[model samples]
Target: MSKDNAPATLPPVKRRNAELVMLGVALAVTVSAFGASGLALDGSLPVGMFGYGIGFIAITIGTHVALRFIAPYADPLILPLAVFLTGLGLAMVWRLNQGDGDHAGAGMQLIWAAVGMLLCLGVLFFLKEPRVLQRYPYLFALAAIVLMMLPILPVIGIERFGARRWIGFGGFTLQPSEFAKIALVLFLSAYLVLKRDVLSLASRQIKVFGFRVFDVPRLRDMAPMVVAWMLAIMLLVVSTDLGTSLLMFGTFLAMIYVATQRSSWVIIGVSMFLGGATIAYFLFSHVQLRVMIWLNTFDPEIADNEGWQLVQGLYAMAEGGLLGTGLGAGRPDQNFAADSDLILVSFGEELGLAGLMVIVMAIFLLVERGLRVALASREMFVKLLATGLSFIFAFQVFVVLGGVTRLIPLTGMTTPLMSAGGSSIMASWIMIGLLLRLSDNARKPAPQAIQDEGATQVISR
Candidate 1:
């Protein structure tokens, strides 16, 4: 073929290069900070820096490669944003580890990030079509439920930090809740796509002040939400992991509303959630304790016990003020929980409000881009998937931040990507990969046959 007739295939390569360049700059900044902080190094300079930096770069590149397979038409900004968040999290975790005398989590986190990148690529390479997931929503939901409940399964369940939410395996621990969220999202999206029309149907109404309020949904119609709510409640009451429970419930509610587009559903959901929470607050001792602690974090009476973590987190945030105490020079090590649930507080302390705002804005941008992908999607399944994933991101952020800031009762939820948890890092990357796949699909021009079939289906419906 002539030079003019040669295939135009450099766009993707160019885009990937741009993403790599951005990541490289971020990595360089992070490495520079680590070196300048005068923190004790775990290993030789070459080995430590190379291991950490290469691991991050690999994860970022692997995520983008996975997106090419799973969500080939996703927004360009999504992958880069994910890389930034992951890198920021790693930086903060490393900094905190230096002070806390536990360099293992940061190093282990790097390893997990690499493993997670592989998982992302595997999902993308194997699960090439979104429709393939629709065939097994029931099975997936059941598996997800089992995985979620594993942490509380009689003798097998392991308790940590006063919560039975971990499954121990040979010297390591795994949080099934993380995988459960992903499975639930997929199952919910599939279920919603199948029942979208039925859910949109209004069964009955109650007239009040010239306004007709919808009556309660039939048992069959409410089964999904009922089961989901029960699962969430079980996680809260049994495992005492209120953060994950609340986040899962919120994500479910968001997906249902998006799926059915019913204002009544939202109202009913809120009512049910509050009613259930109130009941649980009185019924469960743990729930009551959290509420009390949240209400009195500053009170000296409870500040030493139930309110300790919150108080410390608040202090960290306040001490940092607007510009932070610098990356490696904060008091995050003053509390034991600083590395997990209170990591954001630590980030806010060392990086200041400005740094925290940057992190928050990055998350918001990623989620906003996801919603855009959902809106642009041509298929119901793809739209629901995108929206569901975005809700997961948004809900997780809200729950974690709210818990740290005492906007709500603390639930011990780990911040996504930023928290020092293997499960979270893996699940987050998987979600980003899925979102990129959906966005890619959204960006692609619809084949003529699909357009024609969609038109026919709409007309017939």
Candidate 2:
């Protein structure tokens, strides 16, 4: 072909380069936080500051390299945002450890962070096709059920802080519900993709005076929602975990909305959840206490009892005011579950509202990118999966931060990437991995078409 007729060359995408640069910025912020916290706490740099910085850089850079190899077109900002949150969490956890006179919690968190990254890598490596998950929706649903139920078993089930949500095995206790959330999302995404048509179009039209008022799905088509409602109610009754029950059912509802584009499903889901929660509130003292605390957090009687955590967190944030007490200057250690349920509140106390907003914005961006991936994807299953994962991630953060800020009743949900639990960390990273994979598929260029003897072929696999 002549030079003028030759194909035009496009510049290579610099997505990986952008990711590397943002990772560096995130690393700098983390190191600075560690240094600042150490100086404020002990009048000297912590002995492990360099070690933590090096470990963080290593893990983040390593993950970036892996993405370049496997998912070069993935969203560049998500990894850096997550690293930023994890690093801040580490700084806070380590600072809190100073009050306890031990490094166990910080050390364990670092180890789990590494494991979470490895699991993320495993997802990218092994999950060559996200659609494969669609093949076994029932299995994923069953796995979610078993995981949620594990903590209720007689031999291993353990109750902590009035919630039976963890299973003890030997020395370590694991919150199986954290991972169950992902499994449930997978199942719902797959199932909804297949049933959306029926649920959306096969509805019974309710008309009055020859005008259609509303549409109701057939009773058979409502099976998924019914099962979800029952499962959520059972989870609340047995586990007393309002957060997980709300999260799972909420994610299911959101996926149903995305799949079917129907408002009635959401209305039904919300009504069922509210009714079930109201029943539980009257029947269970724990539920009643949570509601009362949320309603009257400053009431002296409730504040001294069930509302103590929320009250303390509110006071800390108030004390910090707009600028916070500067990293390690606050007494976050005085609050129970400060490293997990109240981590955001802890940040608000030390970093002030400004720093807290930065963290929240980072989370917002991560979720926005996930939804963008869903919008970009061509497949129904992939789109639903991305939407489900993103919604759950955002909702979990909202639930945790809301509880701490008294925007809602306190629940035992941990802030993802910013919490101090192995299960939560690992599950969060796995979700990130899935999001990266889906984003890669969404953003990567489609294969060029080819002409055969008498047919055309398009290569995607």
Cα lDDT of model 2 by residue, 1-461, tens digit: 79997658542253889888898999999999999999998899988999988988898889999999998888888899889999999889888888767688888898899999999989998997899999999999999999999999999999999899999987999999999999998998888887878889755777899997667888788888889999999998888898999899989988998988888888889999999989998998888878889999999998898888889989988987899999999898898888888898889999999989999899988989999999989999999999988998889988988888778788899998989999999999999999999988777765541133114223432
Candidate 1 per-residue C-alpha lDDT over 268-319 given as tens digits, one digit per residue, 9 for 90 to 100: 7777778888899999988889899988888888998878888888888999
Q: Which residue pairs collide, candidate 1?
A: 70-437, 71-436, 71-437, 72-440, 73-439, 73-440, 74-439, 74-440
TM-score of the candidate numbered 2? 0.93
TM-score of each: 0.88, 0.93
Worst 10 residues of 1 by lDDT: 38-47
**Number of the top-ranking candidate, with TM-score as the measure:** 2
* Quality of model 2 by C-alpha lDDT: 0.88
Q: Give RMSD (Å) of candidate 2 vs. truth.
A: 4.2
